[model samples]
Target: MPRELVDYRDSEEALRASEARLHEAQAVGRMGDWELDRDTGSMSWSPQLFRLFERSSALGTPDLNEALGYYSLESVELTRAAFWAAIDTGNRRELEQTVLLPSGAERYHATTIVPVKDGSGRVCKLYGTTQDITERKLAEQELRRKTYEIEDLYQNAPCGYYSLDANGLIIRINDTQLRWQGYEREEVVGRMHAAELFSPASRALFGQVFRTFKRMGVLHNMDMELLRKDGSILNVLMSSTAIFDAQGNFVASRTVLSDNTDRKQLELERTAHATRLADLSRHMVDVQENERRKFASALHDHTSPNLAALQLTLTNLARALPPAALPGLQPLLDDAQALLLDTTSGIRDICTNLRPATLDYAGLIPAVQDYAQQFRLRTGIEVHLDTADFTMQLPSNVQSLLFRIAQEALTNCAKHARARNIRIHLSNRDTRLVMRIADDGVGFDPHHLGEAGTTSPGIGLITMRERAEFAGGRFSLRSHPQSGTEIKVTFDVGRSGVLRPARRASDFANGTTLPTGTQ
Candidate 1:
């Protein structure tokens, strides 16, 4: 072969190899190159450009006007302006354009335009590269949408969020917290300390605990009062997490605040309602006691006197008739006199039970002693009364309450316990007054009360408990089968509503135990 022919063949083969590599690179990158004749408006496109427009290569490259048709309506004018501007300024320009393909699908593209100038600096042709950027553009769009959603949620959440720097200055705060404190973002972000948001009292409390919280790294459900710009108070439950640096030193804190005003208001309302109910119950007890006293007084003054006079008149009539018909009428007089005496005794017993006059005159100790003696006589049960340690003089109502509780306990013992021995004890420890009544009897199960077909002693037990509670004392009962029954009532002598002291009860007692005689 001739030497010149061999060199030409080698050169042509190298050129073909370079063109093939260029085509492959364009295809892989989804990019294409094009050139436009400045004068004739003719255009030339690479093979990848044909694919990018979804057009057939057989048709060849179109003119500039025809090529612009491949772009979306909105992108057409923008692309034309860039081409013209490149020619006018003889400069390179880059733009993103939306392409409308033959298949009616839209694609995003990045185009770079360079103007070719001749020796006189007169632009002759324009060249540019277009890359299919659809996937990248879609990813960017999705990221922007998610960013917007996250920002919205952070700014408008139901609970307030704020962050403070290591120096306790408010560093970052969400919109919700700004609204809660009646502040603008600019007002609090860098100018105010976290503790400054609280009321004076709460500020002092927060100052005391905040240092501890920083070291602990977490805080939960701390109740706080926020002083708003409008001078109103907002109750809140605050929780916090501490942020630290690499060296394990505190750097910032993230805090959340939940509104607790409604719950606080509910608690206050419930307390007021309970107080009202207690007052009403105390008033009712007082009224009931007064009525019982009046009824007992009526029976003692009128009924007892009338029965005594009737017995005296019968005695006088018998004395007048005895001499004339002594033997025959003497038995009749004796029977009438016995009946009258028994009736008088029954009336006196009724009056005592209704309202023991000793309870009003001699206080609780003597009243309980007298009742216990009568209870022992009636039920054949041994009675033990111990008030050795009880030295406080209780309010009249408390004394009455304790006495009534003891009375009902004794009655239940007689009716249901079938007991043989009873002990009544009273004592005062510190500011508390305690009374206990116990019986050695066949006790029933406290839990199973009113469960079977038997008559439940629960009604009497309930009455005793109510009496104790209404007087602002605590009541408790203990009972078990084959064991015994015990009732305990405790009053807080320090509490005004529950109990109050005057002089010591020992002042009223004749001795350690009062005389157990009928009053």
Candidate 2:
């Protein structure tokens, strides 16, 4: 072949290769190029443009007006406007357009138009590129929706949320907490310290714990009182997590607060109700004791004296009549005297049991001793009173309550505990009193008390417990089969009311020694 012919063929081959590369690039990018002839209003499209509109290459590129039909109604107007603007201004324009394909499917495209001007600066042609952006657009829409949802949840959740800086200043706070404290966002965030939100006592507590919290990085369920804008207090349970810097230094904190005002109020009201009930019970016990004293006094002063006088008059009459018929009537007089003496003795015993004068005159120790003596005489149970460590002056109600509990305990031991011995131990410290009545008996289950079809300790035990509790003392019973029964009552002597069970007493119950003064 001639050199010119060979050169021409080589140039044509190079141009064909360049066209092939352009075609491949457009397909990979999901982009197509198009041009509009300004004078003829005809349009030309790349092969990718054909695919973009779902049209076959055989149908050929459509005219300007026909091409506009591929876009929806709104997009058509926008496309026309963009074309004219590019022609008028000779500037490149970019916009996103919605394209309706031949298959009734919608797609998103980013369209850029660059006006091609001739040498005279007259806009003779318009060229543009449309890239398929449907996937990117859908992904962006989903991301925006999720962002809005998360923001909404953060701002409107039921519990209060806030963030604090290392300096303990309020850095970020949510709308829910703003409403709770009756403050606007501007007033709280960045303007106030975290301690300002709490009452004086709670603020002091928070300050003390915050330093430790920074080192630990976590705090859970701390009770706090918040001072609201209106000067009222709100109770909340607060939890916090610390955010740290790269160096492990504390940077900020994320805190959540749960409102427990209603729960706190309920607790206070419950405590008040319990206090009232205890007061009423104590009053009733005092009243019952007073009535017993009056009844015993009346029998002792009037009934006993009258019975003794009647006995003497009957004796004198017997002596006067026995002179005439001494031998026959003497036995009848003796029987009458014996009946009178038994009646007098029974009345005296009843009076002593009702309100023992020793109890009122000599206090609890003597009262317990006297009652124990009588209990031993009646039931043949050996009683031991241990008061070697007790040396406090108790309130009258406490003394009475202890005596009554001891009395009931001994009575129960006599009735149920087929025991040979009882030990009544009394001990006290500065303000605490402990009394334990233990019996060496065949013990029964304490838990089964009052249950049907079970051998119980009986109502006497319940009465003893009530009496102890009514006087502001704690009562406990420990027993098991073959282990013996022990009844314990503890009181706060200073308060003359109930005391919580001491740990030492529990230790002692488990067969360990109590502190120095108690058994």
- What's the distance in Å from true for residue 456, model 1? 2.3
The sequence of per-residue lDDT tens digits that candidate 1 reaches over residues 246-296 is: 998999999999999998898777655555655676778778778888998
> Where is model 2 more than 4 Å wrong at Cα?
1-25, 54-60, 70-73, 100-106, 294-302, 315-334, 341-357, 447-455, 469-472, 494-519
TM of each candidate vs. truth: 0.85, 0.85
lDDT of 2 at 377: 76
After aligning candidate 1 to the native by TM-score, how far in Å is the CA of 328 from where it should be? 4.6
Predicted structure 1, TM vs. truth: 0.85
Determine which window of 10 residues in candidate 2 has minimal summed lDDT.
Answer: 508-517
